[model samples]
Target chain A: MFRIAIEMLLYDKTKYIGLLIGVAFTAFLVTFAMGYFAGFMTRGFALVSENPSAKVWVMDPSVSSAEATINMSDSALDIVRGVKGVNYAAPMYLGNMTARYANGDFQTFQAIGVDDATLSGAPKPANLLRIPESAIVDSGGTEGKLQTPIYKKDMWSYDGSHLNAPTRKLRYGDTMLINSKRVVVAGVSHTIPRFPPRPLLYTTASNFKRLVPGEKRYITFIMVRPTKNITPNKLAKRIAKQTGLKAITSDEFKKETVLWYMINSEDVGDMVNMVILAMLVGFGVTGVMLYMFTYENIKQYAVLKAMGASTKQLSDMIFTQVFISAIIGSGIGVGIAAILAHMVSSATFPFRMMWFAPLIGFLGVIIVSMTAAFISLRPIKKMEPGIVFKL
Target chain B: MSKIISTCRDIVKNFNSGEAEVKALQGITLDVYENELLMLVGPSGCGKTTFVSVLSGLLSFDSGVCKLMGEDISTMSDERLTAFRGKNIGFVFQAFNLLPSLSAIENVALPLTVEKRKRVETLTLSKEMLEAVGLDGKENVKPSGLSGGEQQRVAIARALVHNPKFIICDEPTSSLDHKSGQIVMELLTEIIKEKGASMIVVTHDNRIYKYADRIVHMEDGRIVKVAS
Candidate 1:
């Protein structure tokens, strides 16, 4: 009987293909949309992820996310260091500044300041280009437009504001201007691109204060490491208690950053709407196609009923058809999504195919198939066996 | 005398078509005996098809007593009635009603499969039944590939494959040519006699009336005459 059900569904190649297409489209769209959402949220806490050595972060009480932080008093660093479980605390400065290329091209950049002695929050060298231990280096220019140009003694500025054509990519020993002061490009660093992409510039705290020229008490956050045998969460609690600031573990901070973006950003709402639209299309297409398929074969069902097939047997056959469609269609859809995810994925545009993406796609397709099966069953349940004789 | 296999008494069925009530069957009373081919001949709207539907438990009579082999079918639940039908009765439809997706052998094996019989045994039985119906070398041919007479033969083979005690046929030969109709009727009556099963064939075609052991004529939902 199960075999017979499969035969009946497979006999109509048109409807069978239609059903598969409907399910596959749903799965693909849902998976890609959700994957994009996951990737975007991950970038929301890019700062926390970059500085894994920082077990805890102590920030101003008003700070909601990494990108939304307010400057804290420079003295807060010493207070955090005084906590019992704290091993080390470093004052970090985060600000946006403009850098002028040798061609006289100026571009805004995200400037990060680490401790001059330790360079505590700097990107790990294992994941980046190796630099000399003695060189005073700054890193940026991972993007195409931000790449620096080699200097030419005889060449003057093409536009006097932006370079018309860059002769060569920037390398070590190239010089750029920051705040009208010459700054040499010592090393290039690779990092995950920030949301609303901006090139990053890393420098020591003293250099940042000198380059930007600001008032006193300019520390944005204090990155702290817990002492041996003390957990990050425990240290964070102690720091918050001592400094009367918002202190949280790195993971907790990341979550808070993502949550703030989810609540405040319109982009999240747009992504959610795409997911809902995909679901509706899935349900509508599958339900209507299944119903149409069943309607076309109603006479066959009547013949089966009149020939003494019990309702349970017939129902099982219909469900069997639906189950097969759901599995095959979902597999095809997820496979397509994975391929597309591989193609369009980049550091700037976040698209992560998390393990849950396929599971969610499969579950969603199953639900659509089941709803379609129920819709198709309505007519069969109401059919009279005697109608076989009439038809 | 042939053993009585089924009895129908005072069966009345009315159907509602919007605001009007149409009487499909009026006080139909008949007996079907074992190893006999009974023909119910009537024009359209004369209730022969409705009577067989009630007798075969495919329909509910507004008021009647319908019993198959001593069990009252009208009192049976849908599940029980369907089970009983699968175990004891077979059907042949006007259009052959063969599933186009399935080959002749699979069509013939349907009743046994519906009962969830062993696959090997069901196929063997179905093949033999097809052979008996003179469809020996065409077991794997689907209905679309078969001629009308060949398709009807497959339907007859399906009806007899499960060894049911009763068979109900509605306009079994109405769609075939005269010669094909004659061939189908000969094949059907011969198989029923060999299997010792009773059959009720409802049709208005008079060309094959000679195959009947008994004939009941109906008019306006009532039995008009009985001929033998």
Candidate 2:
């Protein structure tokens, strides 16, 4: 009976293919949209992700996320260090600065200023930096939005600023003006992108102060490592209690960052909407197609009924057809999504192949299949076996 | 005296078409005996189909008794009736109602499969039945791949595969040519006789009436005459 059901489904090549495509489209659209959403949220807390060793983050009380920062007073670093169970603490500066390339192209960057000595919160190969003198650009930005022009004989004018030169990539020793101050790119670090997607520049706290002058205090966050015996949560609470500032474990800060982005960003809402719409479309198409398939074969079902097939046997046959389509369609959909994720991520878009995305898509396909099967069962249930004689 | 395999007593069945009630069968009374081919011949709308449908348990009568092999079918629940039909009655349809997706052997195996028989056993029985119906070496051919005569042969094989007490054939030769119809009737009558099972063939085609052991004529939802 199961084999017969499968053969019946496969008998009409056009209908079977249409059903698969409907299910596959749904799975692909939902999974890809949700994956992009997760990728963007992950980038919402890129700073925390970079500094895995910093278990606790101390910030001004008003700060909700790493991107939405308020500069803490310089004394907050000392206060965090003085707290019990605090192993080591370092002040970090986060501020936006305009970079003017030699070719006079100006771009805004999120400048991250780590401790000159320990380089806390800096993405590595930051340890290889000559203490406070130079900067590192994120690898993604080096390929996009931040390219420097290479010289061409006919492309250049008298002065370098107006030169219409063919571009070569920025590399080591590329110098740019940061807030009218000269800074050299010492190394390129591979870092996760930010939510709003700006180029990241890493430098020392001293260099940061030099680039953006005349601030009384410039510490945006203090990265703290808890003592071996104390958990980061306990240390954060102690630090918060002592300093009257917001101190939270890295995981908590990441959650807050993701939550803040989810609340504030319209892109998240759009992605979620797309996922829901895709699911609905998938469900509708599958349901309609299955119903049509069953209706077209209503006579065949009557024949079966008149030949003595029970209602349960007919139900099993319908369900069997549905589940087979669901499993295969979902598998094909997820496979396409994985390939798309790889292609889009290589093009520097926010897409992560999270494990749960495919699982959710597969489950969604199953649900759609089940609904379609139920819809198709209506004709079978109302069918009279006597109709076989007439039809 | 042939053993009586089925009895239908004053069976009445009605249909609702819009606001009007159409009487499809009016007090039909008949008996089907073992190892006999009973033909119910009538013009369209004469209740021949309705009578067989009730007798075969594919339909229910409003107020009458239809007993097949000594069991009252109208009193059986849907589930029990379906099981009984699966185990007792075989059907051959006007259009050869073989599933287009299934091969000849698979079509023949359908009744036994409905009875929850083992796959190997069903296939073995189906293969033999197809051979008996002169469809050897065409077991893997789908209905569309076979001619009308061949398709009807597969349908006949299916009807007899489960070794039912009786076969109900509705317009079995309507779609076949003269020669094909004769061949199908010859094969059907020969197989039913060999199995000692009765058959009820409801058709308007008079060409194949010579194969019947008993013929019942119907008109305006009533039995008009009986001949042997």
Candidate 3:
């Protein structure tokens, strides 16, 4: 019976190719859309995902997501480092700052400052750094010469007193004014998985304090690493109790990132809607094509019925044909989607394929193809054996 | 006389088109006995197909009862009638109604498979039936690959594979050439005798009348004559 169904599906390759293409395109659209959505969400929380040293992040109790918090204190770090599980704890700062170029162009940039002794959340260094005044700028972030000055000759400045620009050219050993104080660029770093947005600059916590000008005791957030026996969640609870603040693990932070995107990000919802709509269109096209195929073969179905085939036999055969189409089409579709994702990633598009999305898409195609078959079953089930004998 | 495998008494079938009702079969009484080859000869619009459909439990009569193996077909629900038909009857049609997707042997094995017979056993039996119909090496060939005569032989093999108590052939050879038609008629006759199963063949072609153990002629939905 399965053989027969497969043969029937293959019998009209030209006709079914159209249906297969419809299903394939639908699968590709669904998978690609989902991949883009996931990529976008990851970008929204790249800071947390890329953090390597922080086993637990202490944040404001009311903060639902990583980006929603305003609470930061050195008091929380002192207490967390004193816990039994804590091996080392350091302050981490995150805030939005405006960077003005020599052309007077301003862009909002996320500023991250970590202790020079323990750079837990800092960007991975591609070049050597030996000075505390020296900073690393993401080379991909700004358009400037390797060692030439692009900005004004004067030292750069920020609105807050915590940050200081040491140099105008932003090269090694060049001084720019950051918050009335001067700092230097030590080295440059390249891209990493889930890197922060372009035009990002990294500097030391001492330089950051010059721009903000608060009690040097306060930090934006705390980073902690557990000892062998200390679990992140347990340490987080201990810290929360001691400092009256919230401590969240990296996994918990990731979840909070996803939650934040789901609540605040409109692109995620739009992508989901688009995927669903594409699937519906795929089902509709396949259904119409399959219906026409069945309609063309109506006489054949009647003939089989006249030959003593039960209704169940006919239904199973048609369903099998639909199943075959979906399997083949989805396989081809996912293959194309994977290739496209890889190729497009090198370009400007932020496309990342989560292995699970294609699997879900494959299952989605099966369900949609079955739905197409179900729509065509009405004509098959109604086929009268008497029609075969009619003159 | 052999046992009466199927009997229909005063069966009436009517079709309703909006408010108008057309009578297709009226007051038709028939008895099909085992081991008998009954041929129903009639003109177009004479309700031959309708009578056979009703007898096969494929359609219901407006009035009167149909009994197959002494079970009331008319009173049985569609589901029960279907089950009963699958077990007790085989059918061959004018168009050589073989499932084109299935190979010759697979087509012949359809009934056994529908009966939920074991796969290996059904295939073995189907191969034997195909060999009996002189399609020995062609079992794996699909219907489209075979000639008209070969396809009809496969159809005959399918009908007889289950060894049902009764067989129904409606214009079984109408689409075949004269020689192929004669061959099919001979094969039907031989199988009917070998299995002791009753067969009712409805056809306008009178060339194969000698193959019938009994011939029933019909006109205007009533039996005009029964010749033995």
Residue range B1-228, candidate 2, lDDT tens digits: 988999988888988856798898889889989998999998999998888888887777788888999999988998888888988899998988999999999999999888889999999999999999999999999999999999999999999999998899999999999999999999998888899899999988888899999999999899999999
Off by over 4 Å in 1: A84-88, A98-107, A123-188, A211-217, A225-244, A346-349, B1-3, B18-21
Model 2 chain B — which ten-residue stretch has the worst lDDT? Answer: B52-61
- List the RMSD of every prediction in angstroms: 3.9, 3.7, 5.2
Q: Return whichever of 1 and 3 wins on DockQ.
A: 1
Q: How does residue B12 of candidate 3 score in lDDT?
A: 92
Question: Per-residue alpha-carbon lDDT of model 1 for B74-188, expressed as tens digits?
Answer: 8899989999998899999898889999999999999999889999999999999999989999999989999998998999999889999999998899999999999899988
Cα lDDT of model 1 by residue, A1-391, tens digit: 9999999989879889988898888888778877887778777677788788898998999997898868988888878878898889998899987877677667677888778777787665522212321112333323564555554741335546446655465566666678876666655667765654567877777778878886576789899999998999998888888789999999999889888887887877777787788778776876677678777888888778777788889899989988998899889999998998888784345888889888898898888778888888888888878887876
lDDT comparison, 2 vs 3, better candidate: 2
Q: Write the per-residue lDDT of candidate 2 for residues A1-391, one digit (tens) a residue.
A: 8998999999989989988888788788778877888788788788898889999999999998987888988888888899999999999998989988767777788889989888887777877556446888874333466667776432223555644556665678777887788888887787887777778889988889999999987999999999999999999999999899999999999999988877877876776777677778766876777678778888887778777889899999999988998899888898999999999989878888788889888898888788878988988887778888876
Q: Which stretches of candidate 2 lie over 4 Å from their true place?
A: A60-62, A98-106, A123-144, A147-190, A211-217, A227-245, B1-4, B9-12, B17-22, B60-65
Ranking by TM-score: 2, 1, 3
Residue range with the least summed lDDT across 10 consecutive positions in model 2 chain A: A151-160
- In the range B74-157, model 3's lDDT, one tens digit per residue, is 888655666677777888877777877678988899888777789999999999999999999997898899998998898889
DockQ of each: 0.65, 0.64, 0.32
